[model samples]
Target: MACQREDELQELVDEARKIAYEGKVANYIPALQKQNPEVLSCAITYPNGKCVSAGDINQSFSLQSISKIITLAIVLMDYGVDHVFHKVGMEPTGDPFNSIVKLETSSQAKPLNPMINAGALAVTSMIKGKNAEEKVEYILKFVRKLCNDPDITYCNDVAISEFTTSFLNRSLCYYMKGGGVIHGNVEEIMEVYTKHCAISMNSLHLANVGAVFAMNGVNPVTGERVMPKEVARICKTFMVTCGMYNASGEFAIKIGIPAKSGVSGGIMCSVPGRFGIGIFGPPLNDIGNSHTGMKLLELLQEKYDLSMF
Candidate 1:
């Protein structure tokens, strides 16, 4: 049965790769604009230690907004759930991923959730670092340890490009500061958040990262406990509730797993006690999720019965 499932997963990977040809690479960021839209990769690691991958699994892409989940996890681990919640709420905001109106509306607008830009910046600020560089280094070390890939580094071109075009995010940071939700300098927080987004990794590494969460913070392959069980649970919950921006609701109904998407066309999913999936295709749908990537997850979920709920 395991071998048969592997065959089926391979078939799905092949079919999903073909859809990449129908989409275009994301062009907003100059760095992301150069991605090969036709490139597709899928990697899945089951809880019992089975694994399968196909297509351009070696292709690298920036983490983009996907870094939000990692930063939020680290913050929760370092500060506990209660302390983190005091700065950012867990409710899903029905607005766009980069919406600043929500931040300016009320004194209580504490960034809806950590998956969005506003909330991610807030989470980044809560890392307890003495300075911006310290915070970025801390995040990098945590991410490398989570994936067990020490070679992972920030893409300077991607980071600079995002920083140059992040007027909205900068505005959100200032608004958060005004609300007293973020304590540090606005520039420092934005720099940390943007740099994290700029960190690059391939689908295989991302799959391992997701698998760690799926195994409740333990890297099944290495037997390393990267985070506490409760922190992993909270990260998964946020992924299910707000990972795909406004499209999260539809993704939950269809895929039925805790997942997160980045504007760079990456999707990271976790099926508790089952498997972790990482997929990449650069074209984005209206809601900033990878179009082909979403369809691929739906197909995999239906075929493998991988839905958590």
Candidate 2:
């Protein structure tokens, strides 16, 4: 099946590339401003250790907000779901990912979910670490294991740049802190949050991580259990609801599976019981998702009837 798909991968890439220009690169982040907005890349890995990839598959980009999925699982793995949920709600807010409305107005002053900025900050605070560097180290180590790529690394430049311009994120963190949603110094917690966002991956590396989620926390290639199946269930459930920012519903309707997109033009997706896909196209739509990446997934999902719905 993978061999068959490889034959037509270029056709899909060409089709998606046409619309890449409709969206522009995310320039606010200093390090991301230099990305080639026209580049479109994808890699899909099947359970049988087969892979089909095309375009700029070797190019690396920061994980951006997509790191939230793994971090959510990490905190859940360490603290258990009940404790993690106590700090953050289980539902999406339908507002922008960085919006501060619910954190202040909600009765409990909790974040609506872990995938958004406010909730991600709260969840990051829950990671059991004596300091920010230690917490981020744990995440780096675990994500490398998840991807099954020991060399997977963080982009310090991206992290420091985000930290420099993180006024809104800091506001969200401190606001949640005041409400008792997160317990830590605002700067320390925000570092943990944005630091994870800087984890870097090429399309293939990102797809490997997606494969774990698709395979219920097992790496089909190495036969390693990365997390409990129950934990993977929690991750996928959130990916469906909040993974694509407010466009999650649209993505689920169109592409119709679990997926998460990052600001660095990376999208990670899982086709339950089948395969995982990674995409990178720097230009972004109004909703802050990879423009060509989303289009390509829509086309492939439709052609292959991959929608879980």
Candidate 2 per-residue C-alpha lDDT over 150-205 given as tens digits, one digit per residue, 9 for 90 to 100 = 88878899999999899999998878777888877888987887789999889988
lDDT of 1 by residue, 98-181 (tens): 888777774566887898888888898887688888988999998898777888989999999988888888888877877788
Candidate with the greatest TM-score versus the true structure: 2
Report the CA-based lDDT of candidate 2 relative to the real structure. Answer: 0.88
Question: lDDT for each of the candidates?
Answer: 0.83, 0.88
Question: RMSD in Å for candidate 1, one decimal?
Answer: 1.7
Q: What is the lDDT of candidate 1?
A: 0.83
Give the TM-score (vs. native) of candidate 1.
0.95
Candidate 1 regions exceeding 4 Å error are 1-7
Q: What is candidate 2's CA lDDT for residue 165?
A: 96
